[model samples]
Target chain A: MDTIIQCENITHYYGQKMIYEHLNFEVARGKILGLLGKNGTGKTTIINILTGYLKPRAGICRIFGEAMERLSPAAKSRIGLLLEGHVQHAYFNIEQIEKFYSRFFPQWKREAYYELLKKLQVTPVQKISTMSCGQRSQVALGLLFAQDPDLLILDDFSMGLDPGYRRLFVEYLKEYITAENKTVFLTSHIIQDMELLIDDCIILDFGRILLHEPTSYILERFRRFRFDSDAPAFPANDILRNTERIGTHWETYSFASAAEVERELVKNGATVSRLSEDKLSLEDAFIGLTGKY
Target chain B: MYTSLFYKEWIKARKLLLLLLVVFAAAVAYTLLTTIKQFHANPVAFWEFIVENNSIRTGYMRYLPLGAGILLAIVQLTPEMHNRRLKLTLHLPLDESKILCSMSGFGLALLSGLFILSGTALLLGLRIYFCPEIVYSDFIASLPWWMGGFTAYLLTVWICLEPVWKQRIFNAIPALCCISLFYTKALPGAYVPLLPWLTVLMTAGFFFPFYSAIRFKHGVQ
Candidate 1:
């Protein structure tokens, strides 16, 4: 794989609280990698580290073979960053903002930006601060597209978008990235959108990465198994990631085969008369790996 | 790149700049008109007061430059701190210090322009009624206060750029102390001997904002 972003032995903390320790990951070129985690699992922290906003306690983050802290101006031009809340120069109107950013990037695509802006149907004089959250998102996205960077690090792209705008953003971003083969590292609260956009995902639990795999791999193998249990207690084991019991019915999640799960349940002294396995979406797989807590 | 950065700053603070300009004009006009009216009413008494008291009639203008500096810094920098929007600026394909320099440079440059305009207008207006010695003394007397404007603007940038609230408040203490130095000797020609020191402080003030910018970049909060 042609690596675009690499982090080695990254350890970070806030005050005395460790956000993550010895965490490592790499993003390959031309791949969309979704960072899925709960609210405080350091997803944004990773974005900050990758973008050179935050320095990890003990690690080196390099993009395009250059340390993030020392990325050259030329190297920086190759990477586009979308901050949380879709922040841009809100004081500028759509036209003025475009004009302002165009000077920095030699290869700025004016049409690429305007095309996205057209979909928003905002007038040329519409200041970004006056626009709705969804409209602001489109403007931010438009700037990124115009920049046409080789790597895009987007933190929580679906932050405040309505369903229609979210879908529009996803579809537009997908078409653009696919057409240009751009590498993307993004996170979002909305997992369904992640399912539609990310080619691979890194599911982070507290202080550790639980799973890093392709979206298809998790969707294909990870599953939810529901079974009936007359016994009051269900034993904890590595095979079943998480288990919940309601009355006599027990629902569990695992990546194991149905037969192995059934055998394990029987050996665990549970009266499992029936066992059913249901395929999981990305969100389901995310919850299964990280648990529903 | 510098032009674009300046353009962005211009757009952000243009309205405030216009307002500040109006205020500067009004202040200069008011001071000159009041001086004219008082001098016309009692030319001999006013002349005696000017010569014996060694006081220029521009006391009301003492805080105008300082106010301009503060307002300009607030208008220019407050939005950049909002929602951590400075990250977008630092992320630009330029050296972080260079970017910050351009930003602070723009604000300082605007303040410089306004100060020059008002200062020159006051001098020319004073020239109409006073001798070279008196006008020169008054201009010299006002230098420290104008220097305060620059220092205040820089200090405010330092405060606004600091990512940590505690550190921001800490920064303001020394800033206030430094600003107090400019006001300590307000008499005509008192600051003449201190111009060298004030220049040194103003030079240091130019770079003070970078400390906060670095902290912000490191995610010090």
Candidate 2:
């Protein structure tokens, strides 16, 4: 698999607040890579850097093998970006927007854009500003779909989407990725949908990467273990990345297997009244990994 | 592609363009109508008034172009700035410089077209009502006002493109001061002496949006 996106030593700061320090990551060609994190955890900043909207304080962010800040016209033509808030020219209606954008890209497929537009119950003359949030998002999506670039960099696709719209978006995206096998770099706080869609994921919190792994690997290997004790006894070990106790139930999140957790707890002299394995849902895993603390 | 992009920009500003042209034409017609009415009522008195004073009699009409230029910039650039649509525009496969130039070029071209039409109307109105001597002198006096419009549009672009409030204010001060240079009391061609230098400044200021754009791209406030 060839690398399509690469970031090395990406350190950024807004005034005195540091967002990332020596951050590094990569996305392989033809893979849906999700940059998942809590709010204000620098996910959008990374997107901005990659899209050349912002030059980072110090870093090398390459998209399609070219530095993003100075992206070549050819390099730029190959990436379709769905900006946050689905920003589009509010003055343009469906037909006008299609007519407008079609001239910019050589391979623009008007049919591809209209196919998505057909899904919306909007008139050809309806301006984007007048459309509902979901409809506007669809328009933004339709434009990018028509562009048909090799890389799709979508920033927070589910931001203002309702459950139904979000689900529909995810479903469409899943099909699009599968059908096209194009590289995708997306960010979202909505983890459940991301879990279903992303091939690989990077979980970030507080300007640090908590984990970077394939979705299957993390789901199969990483888990939360519950240990109950009559008294307050919370044991910490190198294997457990995070620990939290609510009432008599002491929960431990770790990459270690259930057997390893049980062994570690026994070795630490923590008496366990009840022990059970609870597979961490992606959101739960995000919470557990970042910790409730 | 360039033509399409230009067309997109034209659509954004077309309504405002129509409004500015109507208002501008109306101002010219109003001046001409009132002067004609006065000429009909008392040709000797009005003619003597113009001949003796040798001043352009359009009072508040002089400020029309300046206001039109500022408002046109607002109509053209404000939405893009407000909702981050500039980011969408800058993302196009074309060079950012080309896009910026085309967008600004569209605004400047429309402004100049309307300003020129108004100038011609004023000249024609004066020509139809008065002799060449008065027409030439009066037209010369009004050129500063037209030039003021160009300065206002250029300055407003500078202010609109700036993302930071303080920086906009900072830029506006010099812009306001620069625009004032075009408004000093003088005969119609009084600006002829200073026009060359002012054009140099205005041309330099014309590219101020690009500076703001580069800063905006770097995420600088």
Candidate 3:
């Protein structure tokens, strides 16, 4: 695979608290990779480091085979970035902002930008600050598509958007990325959106990566099992994650097959009843892997 | 590309720029009227006041440039800092230092234009009513005050660009102290001795905002 972004043993800290240690990940070309974590899991920190806004405490991140902090203007032109709030030059009207950004990119597609804006209820003279969050999102996305970069790093692109707008954003982005064969690295608080968008995912636990696999891999193998048991305690190992018992109910999530989970439950010395295997959506799998606490 | 950058700054600052121009024109007009009224009321008394008190009729407008500088910096830079929107600018497909230099250059050019227009108006008005000696001296005395305007503008950029709040406070202290230098001397030619040094100071101060921009880009806090 051709790697577009490579982070090796990256470590960072905010004050004395270690956000992550020796974290490593890679984004291959033409893949949409999602970075998911709970609050304070350093999703934004990684984005900052990758974009050269924040220096890592240790290790290095390279994009297009150059150090991120020192990316040449030519290299920078190949990447599109959308900040967490979909921030743009708010003072500029729609046409003006497009004009402003078009000057920087050699291959800017004016029609690509205006095409997306055409879907919104915005005028050419409307300043971005006056637009709603949904409108601002379209503006930001429009600018990104116009840039037509080879790689796009979007930080929480779905933030502050209503569900309809979020779906619109994902659909537009999915179509664009598919048509252009672009590499994308993104994070979003809305995991359901990620289910429809990302090809690969890296689920971040506290200070470590819990899993990094293709979306299909996780969906195919990771399962949630539930049963009724009088046992007050349940045993957990590497295969079983976050085993919980409430009243006569027992539930756990694992990548093991149904027979393997049944054997493990039987060996745990609990009388299992009503054992059943359920497939998980991305959001449920995410919660199951990370736990509910 | 730099034109586009300039266009962006122009859009953000044009309203305040027009308002500052009007404020400057008003100051010059008010000074011209005051000088004409006082000289007509009592020529000999006005001469005595000019010679003994060393007070140019334009003294009331002394702080105008400084005020203009402060207001211009606020309007030009405050929005960029709002919600940390400077990231959008820095992320442009240009060298970070070049981007910052282009931005500060645009602001400095605008300040220069405002100062030159107002200064020339005051000089012409002074020449109409006073001797060449008084006009020249008055113009010379006003140079440092105008320098204060550019200094305040650049220093304000430095403060606003600083990413850390505590560092911004630290920057403000020295900035205020430096601007205070231009307001200390009262006489027409008093600042001539300090002009070269002030020029050097202003030239060096041009880079202070770039330094703050670097720190901000590095996520210093």
Leading candidate by DockQ: 1
B15 Cα displacement, candidate 1 (Å): 1.0
lDDT of 2 by residue, B110-137 (tens): 8889988988887888788778888887
Ranked by DockQ from best down, the candidates are 1, 3, 2
**Candidate 3's interface RMSD, please?**
1.0
lDDT of 2 at A233: 57
DockQ of 2: 0.75
**In candidate 2, which residue pairs clash?**
B140-B188, B141-B188
Give a tens-digit lDDT track for model 2, residues A1-293.
79999999999999999999889999999989998887889998899899888888898999988998989888888998888877788899999999998988989989988998887899999998899889998898888889998999999998899999899888888888889999999998789989989989899888778789998888887788888855355556567767677776888888888888777777657677577878877888788777665
Q: What is the lDDT, from 0 to 100, of the residue A85 in candidate 1?
A: 85
- Of 1 and 2, the candidate ranking higher by TM-score: 1
DockQ for all models = 0.86, 0.75, 0.76
Off by over 4 Å in 2: A230-238, B187-189
Q: Name the weakest run of 10 consecutive residues (lDDT summed) in model 3 chain B.
A: B52-61
Clashing pairs in 3: none
Model 1 Cα lDDT, one tens digit per residue, A27-95: 999999999999999999999988888988889899999998888999999998998989888999999
